[model samples]
Target: SLDLANGPSLEGIAILNIPSIYGGTNLWGDNPSQKKRRKAQKTKKDKDREFSNSSMSSAELAIAVQNVGDSMIEVVGLENIFHVGQVYAGLRASGKRLAQCSQVVIRTRKRV
Candidate 1:
């Protein structure tokens, strides 16, 4: 287990991430375009592979999400990680908008 009071040192840590085409559902929700792309994944994957090798040069979100996610794995707990789409769906299922559920997160984090 990780010790929160003695979090990992990062004084000289460096992370490198190669940009790749994203295939996950969007944060808010999936749309028709995404559904179509997902259904034809073999073709889309080939195109994504080409584009990633040729034109994808940005890794800002890729790097940051990896860094934060890696570091927080223990803190957040192994079974607690979830995609935002799933969370949004759960909140919507509960008859509350994601924004309303997000306020609960904000307030919880404030207390944390």
Candidate 2:
């Protein structure tokens, strides 16, 4: 939460509001690459259905945000809140392209 009313009062907490996030290494299921591979192996009709439902609708995204917000507020206590209309808008304002964004990077070390 980044509500202006409570923003100034909270001393050392940072609030980040994000947009619709997808395409990552999921623990519950296959990652994007694996999904693509499986889709490739599927029949045309299956492929069509997969692509049709691949993207998250606006309503779905809203629900996801609400769910995350509720969990965060409950776990950490609510604070300042800022509402951005959409993820693309926020990224465009900052001149960032989603393709160029990388959330995390892991490096492996060779045996000594």
Candidate 3:
């Protein structure tokens, strides 16, 4: 299960939007059911990294931004939008080979 409970939180950031595909109403609406099932299996490993009740604050998560995407930029909060330029910073900080994370997909919390 892709345990959203364990994923990073966007509490302090100004959320612009959460992908509709990830929202409750549109679950699996973007893809065929078979594809969704396969993706679910692939993302299951990420559940282990989900946020815990004692999750670190945004500052603490700063270091983690690097590990966010394989190659594509994927900022997940609204405050992060202000630092859109820093997407490069995140790429450099992560230092992981871009080739390894080329399909980066940043998700955002819906702007409210």
Candidate 4:
């Protein structure tokens, strides 16, 4: 239970907006149903090095995003509008590579 200032805390399920690379493979993986599960075709040891590189790139981007979000909390409370240049600057400052993190999506959802 969160002791938030706004309102009562409620539980919810959501897939956090974590970026993923879907190269050559089908998106959403092979999840045929909610109960059954299967392995992704491209595992780390698989021959698809391109997919592996892309996965690493995406993982780095996620970390960079997490850093930026933390700074936003400290630097600008409540709201912030960041430009690509600003994001690049932050990523560069943290020594993160953006070579393969090409696709960027932005979505903001806040309740009033």
TM-score of each candidate? 0.16, 0.15, 0.21, 0.16
Worst 10 residues of 3 by lDDT: 92-101
Q: What's the number of clashes in each of the models?
A: 0, 5, 14, 0
In model 1, the clashing pairs are: none
Q: Where in model 4 is the C-alpha error above 4 Å?
A: 1-54, 57-99
lDDT on C-alpha atoms for all candidate structures: 0.24, 0.25, 0.30, 0.25
Candidate 1 per-residue lDDT over residues 26-94, each given as its tens digit: 232222354454555534443322112332222211111222223221011111223333444444211
The TM-score between candidate 1 and the true structure equals 0.16
Ranking by lDDT: 3, 4, 2, 1
Candidate 2 lDDT, 3-112, residue by residue in tens:
32322232222222332232321111112354554554453333222111333222222122212343331111122232122222342222111111112232335554
Q: Tell me how candidate 3 scores on lDDT.
A: 0.30
User: Over the stretch 8-110, how does candidate 4's per-residue lDDT look in tens digits?
Assistant: 2223211222222222211112223322212222222244322233333332322223222332211111111232233333432211222222333433357
**Residue-wise lDDT of candidate 3 within 7-109, one digit each (tens)?**
5432332211222212222210122355555665565533433333333332223222233223433234322432333333343222111111123333446
Error of 4 at 10 (Å): 24
Once fitted onto the true fold, the runs of candidate 2 whose alpha carbons sit more than 4 angstroms away are 1-53, 66-112
**Which scores greater on TM-score, model 2 or model 3?**
3
Task: Identify the candidate with maximal TM-score.
Answer: 3
Which is superior by lDDT, 1 or 3? Answer: 3
